[model samples]
Target: VLGLGNVGPLAGKPVMEGKALLFKRFADIDAFDIEVQARDAGHLIDVVAAIAPGFGGINLEDIAAPVCFEVEETLQAMLDIPVFHDDQHGTAVIVAAALQNALELQGKELGRIKVAIVGAGAAGIAIARMLRALGVADIFLSDLHGVLHSGRRDLTQWHKPFAVAPQDWDLAAMLRGADVVIGVSVRGAIPEAALPMLAPKPVIFALANPDPEIDPAVARRLRPDAIIATGRSDMPNQVNNVLGFPFLFRGALDCRARQINQPMLLAAVDMLARLAREPVPDAVQAAYGLTATQGLAFGPEYIIPKPLDPRLRQRVSGAVTVAARESGVARR
Candidate 1:
């Protein structure tokens, strides 16, 4: 992990350490959390590349965007081994998985839903791309300014391809009648007022950590039929990257994958979604303090596998490894 200071080094350090711990605990994959003091993206890339040969894969975490984009792209191009930025792809995979199951529970198809993604940052872009790969066609993305449409002169190259024709709609307008609203934006971005504007029984993923774009409780009160998820452990259907990166890297490393490509990620999404639909193990239920009386089976509230589920490593890794081989990105 680079840029460990302003991005909350004190907070991020322990999280990275926990990720390293998960890698070892879950998959027996050895990992070291190296904190680099470098601030510049170029310098960080150089630092990571210099040590690339000693590791099987590089997991980039908590680096700020734009620079984070460059760092991951450059490293992935330069390194023979898989280089993954977990914040972008890991979050995307879990969101896709959760969204898949959420849609399934609602009897909605991925191809048919209109998804409005708030916050056109790295994670938002990655999630939109992953969902597109999963057959979601109608996706509308919004930043602070407005919808990312072709007419916007302020648009970056990264935002251009995803842009639609200029629309009169801001965030609320985009959300109106949309089947899904995914918030990768800031806290309180999705106001309570907008909840009633969405299509009935919409899947709302307010996934801003520590605080969501809109509180799930508030969303439920405003639109009782809404399927809600947040980037919070206490909340039901937490869309966490922990359900992804450890096992993903484990599979990639074990298979000697050349890269963590789209196919591999999509495969992980499929596996995660499928796992949610199966019968929950007693241990997994116990870990979440969920009992049979609580009805913790595949439903709106339990759309994705919990982070503590022991079967994740074997299942997700196996799916990812097979994808690496099938996509011809595997070296071994």
Candidate 2:
């Protein structure tokens, strides 16, 4: 995986070890975590190639964006094994699922959805691309400067293709009348007032770490009819990437997938959204140990499944694996 910091107990090692463990639990897969002493892309590529023979697939984790885009592209070109940057694709899969369920609850369609991504970083770009593939034509991306538009002079190559030209530069302006507003940006970016400007029954995914762009309470108050989610575990609708990565990688490894193409990603999305809407099984309820009221149900507060939901890995992995096989990316 491409990631940050010198190898030590405090830094990137714990996450690597955790991912390795998740790999084992979900698919009996083995992984070696290599700490790149330098943050150089070339260095990471060399190290990955040196250890390529032991693995059937490559799972890239936690590498920052823009640079991550180059890294994923490079590794895919260099290695025979399917190279997947989990931060990008994994997050995309879960967001797609969450968006689908959110839209369904609000009685909206993907084609007409107007999405505003607060952060134009890795996760935001991936989500936008995936949403586009899902038939969302109206996507607006915002960075620290303002919303990315065609007239913006200071746009990066990665943000250029999805730029919404000549729109209001203010973030609040972008949120106005938006059907779906996703916050992958910094914490507390979406103030309480901004939430009220959303279209009725909007879909808001405030997916920043630790603290979200907007508090769930604030969002709920601003538009009670709106469907809101976050990256936090404490939140009711936790839009965690855990819903997809372990399973996505498992499927890719199982099938010896050559590439993680769009069809495979969409398949994973469909399966996860469908699973989220499934009748709560006795096993699932037993695992969570929550009451029928607190167990599995569909609403703004109870959208995505908890991490400990036992059915997640099997359900998501099965769909992704089948998708790979059908798309001819999987060898098995």
Candidate 3:
């Protein structure tokens, strides 16, 4: 079941219905969207716990940050089935997978690079949190006012873990010498002038929907050596959360996993990264209507699997299932 509420107008209808279709399409998992109303995390948790028993796993979607943390954490603890917040962990998993491949293509080491995230919302904060396990240490975040630092009075518990020391640094300041930029904020959050501030062969994931923080073309023009991706499908290297959730839940349910743990998530990330390097299946190429010569190659343009790739079901889900059992979360 996918828990949906508190986003746009009647979000549980359209946004979740689309996801339900994907769940059915990709993993043969029957998912339904439920609109929830609650004043606090306790109320949300109570509502989900009551209905969660009927479903194999609970997927929390569109719930805001900080509250998302409390609700997901409490619900997972209260139930034996996997409880995952797709907005937080799902987006993070895709970003981590795409970034892993991008870094590899650029010959950059995850441990030696600094990442600048331009948004402190659920997606942004979660990306920073998950990257910690991948050996990324220097992460700086920017919100509306400016850079998130120790002196900021507005830092939430979600933002504190990735915050920098008290400083007057802004986006441009943070980009200087940074090796990568992950944008989950509004368009133009990462200005063109700032692209040059990054170190050589940097990675740019301007993943704001509809419009990215920086246009992929502009970024390519300014720094030809850099590898860029956007949330837009028209652009290559779309780092989307849709590439994540269905397979993750399918794996968890197949294994009867107790909860979606870090090991399971890391396993999914690694699976996706590895999938991109393999030769593209003819079915995936034909699904996208690409001719024989215009094949999807593993490069700057295609760092993650297409949403239609059939191999994702067995490969990603199987990897997560293994991790679930090895991590002692799988009941079966």
Candidate 4:
């Protein structure tokens, strides 16, 4: 089952329907999407409880942050089945994959990389935490209020874990020596002037939807060697959550996972990066009706898998379920 809050104009139904189709195709799991409205947490819980009997797991999508945090917490405490908020975790998983791939291409170890994230909201924080868990060195995060350094006076409890002591810094100063810069915030946060400050040929993932923090054309023009990606499909290295959710939920469903933990997410990321380095498999080739023996290659222009590329979910789901079983999070 899927639970969503106030899908605008019913335009969002197609997205849930697409998920259902993918679930049927890849995992053979049947899913129903429901639009929900609630004045408070209690209403959400009551609505979910009314329909919980039919679903093996619940996927929460497109809900805004902070409220999303509360909603997931409420559902987890109340429901017997596993509950996942795909926006928070799904986006994190795919970004983790992109980061890993970027690091690999650079011949750098994950532990030695210095990173900066431009957005400190749910997706940005989740990505930073997961990267830290994977042993990334020195991840600096900033939001609209500027750097999320320690004791800035406006820090929330959620942003506190990532707070560092202020260092008289600006975004360009932080980007000067960082190995990677990720943009999850608003457009044009990372100005073109900052492009040259990156640690010689740094990997840049400007992932804001519609318009990225740094314009892709501008970044490519200024620093011709930088690796760049965005959240839009028209651009190269599109880091769409569409690439993540179907496979991830498919894995959870296949294993009857009790939770979608860090280990499972990490596993999914690893496989996704590795898949981009090789040829598309027979099954995927047949599914896409393609005759090409070689799969998508990894490079500046192709840091991530295309969303329409049929090979993604099969490979990603297999890896995630394997990790779930190993991590003892799988019920099956």
Candidate 5:
């Protein structure tokens, strides 16, 4: 995690603590957090490359983008071990999984949806790419300045593909009639009044960490038809990357996979979506201390599996394991 901070031992990105506390708790894989002080992308890449042999895989956490892309792509290309940038792919996997189920509950199709992603950083860029792969044609992305459009000369390779017409330059403008508003930007990026501009039954994923762009409670109040998800656990439909990374790495390691490819990622996504549709297990309900009346079953409130769901280890890991073997990326 290049953005590793000294605020505390657990300081980094969201859920940043020695590869997260849940890695061992959920997947039974020994995980530790390593904070590195490096000069540049070359230094960062060298550090991981030197340490690559000590682990089955490397998860790039909290590393900021533009640089994140360089560091990760370089490491992945050079290392036999699967080099995963959780901020980019793991976040994308969870967001996509949650959106699949959310849109399903909302009676919407992926191909017909209009998505506005606020935050053109690594997570936002990866989400846009994954959604495009999922058949979403209309997508607009916004950065700190404004939307990525033809009028912007500062756009990079990552931002260029998702760029749309300059018709909508801001969050409020881009969200008009949009079927989804995915906020990976900073907190409060999505104004409370801007949510009303969305199309009916909009799937809103305010996935910014610590605090989301829009509070889930406020989103629910503003649009009863809205299916809202946040990065917060206290909220319904929490789009936690924990739901993706641990299981993903567990399965990839189980198979001795060479890389965490797109097929394996999409496999995890489908597994998550399907698992949410199944009856909530007693253990899962108990883990959350949810009563029967709380409705643990799949709905707008439960579009993705709980991060603590015991089945995630078997189901998501198994799916990725199978995908790894099928994709011919596994050694064993």
Candidate 6:
């Protein structure tokens, strides 16, 4: 971890520490959360490269936007050890897994859904790419300004490939018939009225931390058949990165992988989706205060495995390790 300044340090310190704790608790993988106050991306890369020899893998926590992409790419190229930006890939894996299960529950296919992702930041871009890898074709990506289309003058290189042709639709208009609406943007961005405009039984992943685009309570009242998820523990089917990153890093480290590649992430997504379909263990049910009648089986509410479920380490790590070897990125 690096960038221990500005919002990065304050927002990222606790998250990195929590991730370290999860790695230790679940997989018996030792991790140390180190914060660096580098002034720029080049300096941060140099600092991390200097210290890379001591660690098996480098997990980039809350480094902001386009800088995070450059840092991860440079470190991956320079170092033999795996360099993973959790904000991008971690959220991507969890969202993919949850979306898979949600589609199954709704009797829909990934290839057939219209996805409207609000927020074209790192997570949103990664999610769109991962979904594309999973066979989702129609993706509508938007930021605060409007939809990301090819005609936009302010488009970045990273956002170019995902951009669609110019359209008259804003976020709300785009949601009119969308099968899935993924929110990685700010709080209360999706109005409650827009919830009813979605296709029937829509999957809403309101993944903004601490707050969501549309409150789950409000969404349920409007579209009772909709499957809702958020980046929150208090809610059911929370699309949390913790559920992905620690186990992912564990697998990468164990395999001595050179990088966390796309195939590895897709494998993790498949494993998570399959894990959700399996019967919930007694211990897991007890941990979440769920009764056999209420939660032992898979359904709309239980789209993704719980964070504390003991089987996650073995399932996700095994899938990722195999993917690393198959993708020719593993050293051992």
Give the best candidate by lDDT: 1
Decreasing TM-score order of the candidates: 3, 6, 1, 5, 2, 4
Q: Which stretches of model 5 miss by more than 4 angstroms?
A: 1-20
Better structure of 1 and 6 per lDDT:
1
Per-model clash counts, in order, read 0, 1, 0, 3, 1, 0
Runs with alpha carbons beyond 4 Å of true place in candidate 3: 1-12
Estimate candidate 3's alpha-carbon lDDT, on a 0 to 1 scale: 0.88
TM-score of decoy 1: 0.95
**Collision pairs in model 5:** 18-33
Q: Please give the CA lDDT of all the candidate structures.
A: 0.88, 0.81, 0.88, 0.78, 0.87, 0.87
Can you write out model 6's per-residue Cα lDDT over 1-332, one digit (the tens) per residue?
A: 22233565556678678878877887788889888888899999999999999988888877777788889889989988889988899999999999999998899999999999998888988899899998999999999889998889898888888889887868777788999999998788888878878998999999886778888998999999999999888888988787898888888888889889999999999999899999889899999787777765788788999989889998899999999999999999
> Which consecutive 10 residues in model 6 have the weakest lDDT in total?
1-10
By summed lDDT, the worst window of 10 consecutive residues in model 4 runs over 1-10
RMSD of 6: 2.2
Give the least accurate 10-residue stretch of model 2, judged by summed lDDT: 1-10
Q: What is the C-alpha lDDT profile of model 4 across 221-306, one tens digit per residue?
A: 99887788888876768888877877887888888887777788888888888777776555655554555545344676666776
Question: What is the C-alpha lDDT profile of model 5 across 216-323, one tens digit per residue?
Answer: 788889998898888888878888888998999999999999999999999999999999999998877887887766759889889999887889999999999999
lDDT of 1 by residue, 1-332 (tens): 32233665555678778889988887788999988888698899999999999999999988767778899999999989999999899999999999988887888899999999998988988898899998999999999899999989998778887899876868788888999999988889898888889987899999987889997888988888888999888888988888999899989988899899999998999999999999988888788777867757988789999888888999999999999999999988
How far residue 283's Cα lies from its native spot in candidate 5, in Å, is 1.7
Scored against the true structure, residue 287 in model 2 reaches a CA lDDT of 73
User: In model 2, what are the clashing residue pairs, if there are any?
Assistant: 150-165
Per-prediction TM-score to the true structure, in the order listed: 0.95, 0.93, 0.95, 0.87, 0.94, 0.95
Q: Taking the tens digit of each residue's C-alpha lDDT, what string does model 3 give over 225-324?
A: 9998888888888887778899999999998898889999999999999999999998999999995479898998889999999899999999999999
- Model 1 spans > 4 angstroms off: 1-5, 8-12
- Model 3, position 286, has a per-residue lDDT of 95
